[model samples]
Target chain A: MNIQNPEIENNVFDVRGLNLWYGNDQALKNINMQIEKNKITAIIGPSGCGKSTFIKTLNRMIENVPIVRTTGEILYHGNDIFDKSMRVEELRTKVGMVFQKPNPFPKSIFENVVYGPKIHGIKDKKLLMEIAEASLKSAALWDEVKDRLNDNAYGLSGGQQQRLCIARCIAVQPDVILMDEPTSALDPIATLKVEELMDSLKQEYTIAIVTHSMQQAARISDKTAFFLMGDLIEYDKTEAIFSNPRDKRTEDYITGRFG
Target chain B: MSAAKLEFLREGREDTMLETDQTHAFERYKVKIDSGRIERRVRLNNGLKHLFSLSTVFALVVLAILLYRIGVQSAGWLDLQFLTSNLSRFADKAGIYGAILGTVYLMLIVVPVTLILGVSTAIYLEEYAAKGRIQRFIKVNISNLASVPSVIFGLLGLAVFGRMLNLGSSILAGGLTMSLLVLPTVVVASQEAIKAVPGFLREASYGMGADKWTTIRKVVLPVALPGILTGSILAMSRAIGETAPLVVLGIPTLILKIPDSVMDDFTALPIQIYYWTLDTVLTPEYANLAAATIVVLLAVLFILNSVAIIIRNKFQKRF
Candidate 1:
């Protein structure tokens, strides 16, 4: 509710004074940050530091938990996502999410890619096929899966499944993509492929990734935010945050003194 | 070197020898295994597994003997005339035409009633019910009801549908009674099926901007449908084989005409077999008629059970 940072720019999201609780226990404390447009922002922290919870709160996906209560204001494109006048479905359509594990539906691969567009009321068959191909192509999956688009998505390997999820996320043409450790479940080869995809994806979409690997954050992100014990310790350019952190705690975490 | 330093060096050399021996025992050496002891353990494990399998075979052998006895008795009497002719006082002139029609009509009523009520109850409990005291209470009571005697459900049907509602031993009354008798079975089976759906599929639906109800209808229902169909088949088989409930409802055991409507009086396959078996005390020939009817009833049950398994296997989806 309080804005500590007075300066503003063409940021995609302006989050301020965000606090969240599950039942009686607080999960995320008062936090403030700005997310720039067309750039990949990485959130790095130890386990249970509220990285996943913070991204879930961005699209109100945490509302699925029966005991969750949040008091915050996240403005996406200058409109408050939590405002009563804003519908949650519309908010989710603009901000898509990919979970840690690959979770394709039991349906065919083509169905998985076009699920978002179908849910949003796109009914033309030709349009849906075109969307599926374009989305798969964008996720770097079309060449590998084009011949077997009608097969069940579950038949794919773990790496391919993750890319299918990525294709599903982009099918709806969302403005922002939020990934919660999308590479944690993948092999090193698949992890590198997704990391390479993220580099090119930032030209069109605002990307926010939560990662446990400090090197992954250093490798892919334009900006890096370090969180510890429900607090944002530092947020700066990726190089400065990793090389010569301003906060002593951030320096210690980067140099492997402690987490 | 001084004398004390020399003594210390000698102690260090001895400690090094002990450390190497300890490390060699755990980290570097491969201890010999006793193959004789391992062989004895494997034999004991296999013995228990074989015992369980033998028990299963023993039960099947008993079933085979019973079926063989009934098959021999029914071999001469099972014919087209035996199936098409109406029931008669003379054993040679009797048939099961009326019972077959009665069963078809009864199922027409019981199938829809049980399916709608049973499946709805399962969905409400599994998906909508909160994890609280009320949900737990309902779940325990439902499972307890499943284990209660089918004859108790018959008594309930007799008192409520037959007497209180004044339906008067009609096919409707019998059908309604059978539905109640099988309702608990259907509900329990459907609950298991719905619970078996993967959690990740529901999460995927919800993450794609679907509401709770939409997720249930579009994602959960399709995945759970095969299991639901399996449950319904078993429930119908249970209903078809049930007799005491219809008897308690006061359905006539000697209907001469086929039931043309749900409101018409009727008798089912089990009731026909029961009356014929009872008549064997007066005339020995009636025993053959009873055996023939038993063979038909068993065939129907086996077919129903097989259909359930086939449907389950055909529609099962891998996630």
Candidate 2:
């Protein structure tokens, strides 16, 4: 059964009966959800609950696992992402990802931010610099790294590096960004910075984040999805899910009764 | 301490232990040190350190003695005239000009061929190939080929490049044979270098919508280049100094003309040293000529290795 928000007919993704497996072990089971456009969707679950796997499926990056097998459909902007006619590169151009660890390339900060634009054939140095400036400002990292654009990215602190990764994603001009526990490795202050950055990012990009922290979901996300044992048990407005969950499992989980 | 104190320390603040029991606990808790065991361990550690240093010194001394002997033998014989002149029947007029040129020409072929073939093979195995029985079989055979005798490679090269291809003992044939001899080492080293590239970098590149080739070219190759270069240089050095493979390939020991092209007949430094050392019985000065040739070969290898180290350092700092 797919859950669609009747009031908001505009959806960015419509997943229908999606199931995934790694070799013989099932990782995601029959998930159906409609992600609305330009909204912050937070997927929170215990470890190994397949929230990460579900987000990776949106861009088809899970295919890199070599043993991953999926059945059903994921429609991105009305195109079946698994269709043979749909190019993976084209799909990924419209979608970007941020990993749990702050993975800035070993290149200079300017180079790291411009990697995507350069690969997409943007050769004009002036244009690349403009894009870099705009993306860094959007990611809220311009003030910290503006003076040292040529320094190696590894020189940045952990919080700044993660922001740089977000800036890197923004330079691609993607419509959606998938984050796999992007703030799990940061301290409380750094986590707060990223959360604030995410609040402003939703104005331009649709975001789907998988987080381990329930409080982070309540604080920043508009839609909340609680997954348990490879199944998406609840998906609704954050207030509804937090205050008046319809499912007993969702109520128990949010109350810290059992995972 | 006393049994009660010991229990208190072990389990943290036993409820029944009062402050009055602490008055006599100091005497009971007096420590006993094992000075004899400590002394024995310290002595053994120092003795082993001295023994290891002595072994290192012994090796260096032997190397120094050998270098001194070669230097003494080649001092008067090695000169600019000796380096410029060609081979002759008399020991006083002999030179290794042809052999030096031949060795340099041989490297021109081996370096490019081995690098292209070895790195390509390694990339195919590490990145493109599927993991299964067929890939495993190919990997096992490549490693096994590394341990096979270099002379065996010479025989294969002789049959394929010399007889079947009709290249004969030309520098082309000898260079191809030497490349085959060192191909396994290059392949193994390149594979290790490519395998050492971290997975996260590849993931990050792909996440940006870059395809496999772009990711490999931009991320993987730059990271693996230093290791691959170092390995290839060491392999080339081995090829430059090898005698058994050239011997099996029927390379000429003495030639009057320097090889201007790969198709021309040639003689290498190791082959010249072998022939001169064999002729030492008839002319004792031929021994000095062989020693002089050995010194030249060592100098060439040293220069090649120094370049490799410099390049490796330059690339290693980028990451």
Candidate 1 residue pairs in clash (backbone atoms < 3 Å): none
Q: In model 2, what is chain B's TM-score?
A: 0.85
For model 2, the superposed segments whose C-alpha errors exceed 4 Å read A7-9, B1-55, B310-319
Candidate 1's residue-wise lDDT over B166-271, tens digit each?
Answer: 8888998999989988888888888998899988777766676766777788788888989999989999999999988888887876787778888899999999
For model 2, residues B65-167, the per-residue Cα lDDT tens digits are 9889999999999998778778999999999888888888999999999999999999999999997899889988988988888889889888999899999
lDDT (0-100) at residue B183 of candidate 1?
A: 87
* Per-residue lDDT of candidate 1, residues A101-193 (tens digit): 999988899999988888778999999999999999999999999999999998998999999998998998988999999999999999999
Weakest ten-residue segment in model 2 chain B by summed lDDT:
B23-32
- How well docked is model 1, in DockQ terms? 0.54
lDDT of each: 0.88, 0.90
